[model samples]
Target: MDYRMFKHRMVNIVERMKAIGGNVSEVMIGAPASLQQIEACEIKLGFQIPESFKKVLLEFSSSCNLRWVFPDEYQLAGELDGIFSGMLHWDLALLKELNDDKNGWVKEVFSNPDDEYDKVWHQTLAFYEVGNGDYIAFDLVDNSTDACVIYLSHDDGEGHGYKLADNFIDFLEKWARIAFVGGEDWQWLLFTSNAQSGLLPDSQSAKLFRSLLKLSI
Candidate 1:
């Protein structure tokens, strides 16, 4: 999608989210990044950022306010809390710092002391941290202009990335559709609960909504 269309769709999605009475005010739109900033990130990462993903960072680095909600099954395990959260764009500086830092959480996943940052994270560019050690990143192994969105679960160990979407745009489209339109049975429950509870739904209901959304991630 072009910049205009992308912006339009995002506005519509945000409105729908507001209508559901969720606390989306923190879903602040970001200022566009300069060409220099984008270039610097590309040079440091050694891979061209996907145009769709770049457009989002240029327009709104972080577009939504979402928290990680673990499914009932994993609640006791406490292993899925950071698998996914709201889609937020990372600042260029943070992205570079994360990519370059050898002692960071990213390094924990590629803990082989012999592995360099580039070699360890070469095919992945982490743009969103889900906290604890998980991330939402672009998979560059295919070297595509529009890379696939993948979830890197630190708790799950290396070589176990979960595929989320074909590309950044695809992921956004699915998020809007699911969160706003309610495709599955559980999703409708979330919408209805939110409507009845007036945005701040009960903890159990809200947890369900968040847990279901994480499935999409």
Candidate 2:
């Protein structure tokens, strides 16, 4: 996927999010990282960062503060913060710190080598914390490109990791759709209610929803 196109699409999504009462100011999009900083992270982690993931970090090292415009009823409801929020993407420095062999949380979580789950964690790179100790990471063992998005849930006993998407772009696109358009069940409910209640003009809601839909496509 074209990085430029992906960035452009994300910018458009943020703008629309603002239109629907999202707190744009609360959103923290960090400055792009330098090549030196990127290389430092790679060296520290001992594994090459996927090109797709690196492209996103180069554009915005960290992004956060995205919230649902509507009330809880209209939201997907999860312990994790909004995907657009910086919470999903770690700062390059933070990523390195998190992967530190001696002081990293990864070591603590994967301490039991005998445990199967801990073994899986060994081959993955934990880039984003999904609150409650869960993480969104890259499954280095399963995908040769090391781009597949996976969810590692520390809280989930036994069976923890789950594949989220095939790549970072796919993950981002899904995140945008769920955030703006709502999930499979919620999307229809949100659109119908907003249109009927005139909370958002029908035409406007339809337009924004259409724009969001196209992003996923």
Candidate 3:
């Protein structure tokens, strides 16, 4: 999408999310990094990320500092579709650190999402397992509005457990950290693709969300 169109949509979404108690500190339409930045990052990581994914880094960069605005609260409802398909979440402090041209920390944080893309919980959980031993999962959710949602499952046979993040950054940080680890037995999943399910209540879902929010902070 063009920057102008993207920015307008983002403003509308952010306002709506805020109405529902979402905490969105900053919004970016295109990749926050430049080409030279990405090249330097690739060298630091010792591998290349998918071009499709890199397109994201080339296009948009977003930061949702949930803690700053919410203090200790996080949204509970999960949206229907994937809001952060290409973007990655970076904390404000981290953003500055990574964005610094001298250190080139931003280049280093860019990572490939793993293959286990199936498991997620709108306003709850999401995961991915790259290969080797790298893995990431959303243990909880902080935001639940039109801007973003999550759907995840527990390993238990009953599918009785799941969680979501209040904002995209929360979700990204959870998974991104794991992807950065890179492992062989990494048997988890994380995805930024087209989400399949629509919004659904988890039966006592509000209670679960409130509980998770308290835990997230």
Candidate 4:
């Protein structure tokens, strides 16, 4: 990653997020930009990233704010797709239990719980090798719709990729080789993980909404 380039991109993203009313903070990763690392990523991933995205990466990596939103999952790595393959957490079992029953306690927690507060969950998991990368996953509580995105970098300071799905069912069928699954059921499973991961807590979640409110005002 090119520190100079990455720095430039981050500035842009921060400014844009600010315009959209996003919380920002400082985050740290150990490394400077290197050409060798970038080339290696391309050989591994077999793809190229658009110039527009590279600009975004430079900004996100060179600065901070590792945790922007609660529901977004950020995955950083030193290799191509190897980040997702690392230390996999088997939360599927717990997820399955939470989603199996509609009237279950877990379902209620995500639904009209706590004086009927409406909740929506979203996740972004960013995976990177040189600088920290992020991947995102998320879902809606009321309707239970889920989505995910994987951000990868390549060509040192020039190439990058972002893989995203509109919802969990789309991700499973289109990306994961799973088919014919009902959207509602799969979203419940994904949303359970979002809640369990603490990506969307009642307080922080409320704060984000407040932030949104201020933006609109």
Candidate 5:
């Protein structure tokens, strides 16, 4: 999608997620980061970020600041996990220090070695970090136009996460549809593709969403 389309979709998701939960203190969308800043960040990370994801951040949020207007709170995980905000770091060298193998920080955090990382774990860079060591990330090595969005677990090496959506936008659309359930939510493991909450559909949180928001699911 074009920058305009990406921006529009992101705005809508931000609005929908915020409306779902009024936890403003938790969500933190930032100002736009300069192209130079984004380029430098990519160099530091040693991988090219997907354009679809890049367009959204470049047109919307800053490197480490909050957007204040939208998608600021999509974090929705432990303490509202920030996406692009956490994906990037203003400090260039910090990338290596953070993801280095010495700290046991797995560059390839996802478990399914063949399917997820494709054995090129070092090429993967996590953009969204769940406060508890998990992440919502994309693989740089993906040759597709829109990179695949994958989940990464800090603790679980065997079953960290698998390919969720084909692209970032699809991922956001799914999250928004489900009221942006908590990041790395237990319900996540329940879905093969789509995520539901209560047992009938998903969790109690999802049931509450259905009753209060009147969602069809």
Candidate 6:
């Protein structure tokens, strides 16, 4: 929990929201997740959680929003939320819902499951939702242990969507550098591609994506 970074940056964002006539909350740094709760989630995920991510849940707020009160404006810059948008609401119920939901989404997206097999839903530690059915998750299937942050579009699997960052903290820091706008699904694509693909400059998702693409090919 990089409390130092939040001191000036998040507080400033709250001030910005207030200046914009947005109804803001009281810097809602919600309660940290109990070890029991995290362990329960890990049991459901079928993978050990990343230590960095686990730390965020354990020491800091498990899930919270540091943004505007309304949904529309929140869509642009989002809340004081650490960029997960609605998906940041990684509540026990939501976590259960996503983890339990294996086949329902598969059935909808993969029209011919038997004929088409790239992996619409790779084993993922989805920490955020992209509004649509896609997710910003850790690639539980490939790099589950350390895991770079990757985008999981509904129709595309491992080989497709971009890998956003090398790790959890990097993801937040980079987005914070970009004012959380780059955290948006589209903004990520636009900047990374325009940079000839590495918005974080050291992002390894590109190499991982290439390797995954080979398997799919």
In terms of TM-score, the best-performing candidate is 6
Encode model 1's per-residue lDDT on 96-169: one tens digit a residue.
77655423654555655355433434467776665455566777777777887655555443323545557777
lDDT value for candidate 5? 0.48
TM-scores, one per candidate: 0.56, 0.61, 0.33, 0.24, 0.57, 0.67
Worst ten in a row by lDDT for model 4: 81-90
| Clash-forming residue pairs, model 1 | 21-199
Q: Output the worst ten-in-a-row residue range by lDDT, candidate 3.
A: 180-189
The local distance difference test score of each candidate is 0.51, 0.52, 0.32, 0.28, 0.48, 0.54
Q: By lDDT, rank the candidates, best first.
A: 6, 2, 1, 5, 3, 4
Best by lDDT: 6
lDDT of candidate 4 over 1-217, digit per residue (tens): 2445434444443443445444544434333324454445434434332232233333322212332221134322222111121111112112222223322322444344343221221212222222232112233222332233322222221112223344332332232111111121221122222322321212343234324323221
lDDT per residue as tens, model 6, 84-110: 221123444366566555335556664
Using lDDT as the measure, name the better of candidate 2 and candidate 4: 2
Superposition TM-score, candidate 1 onto the true structure: 0.56
How does model 5 score by TM-score? 0.57
Of 2 and 6, the candidate ranking higher by lDDT: 6
Q: Model 4: runs farther than 4 Å from truth?
A: 1-26, 29-32, 58-65, 68-208, 211-217
- Error (Å) of candidate 2 at residue 57 is 2.6
By TM-score, rank the candidates, best first: 6, 2, 5, 1, 3, 4
Clashes of each: 1, 4, 42, 33, 16, 5
Model 5 poorest ten-residue lDDT run = 82-91
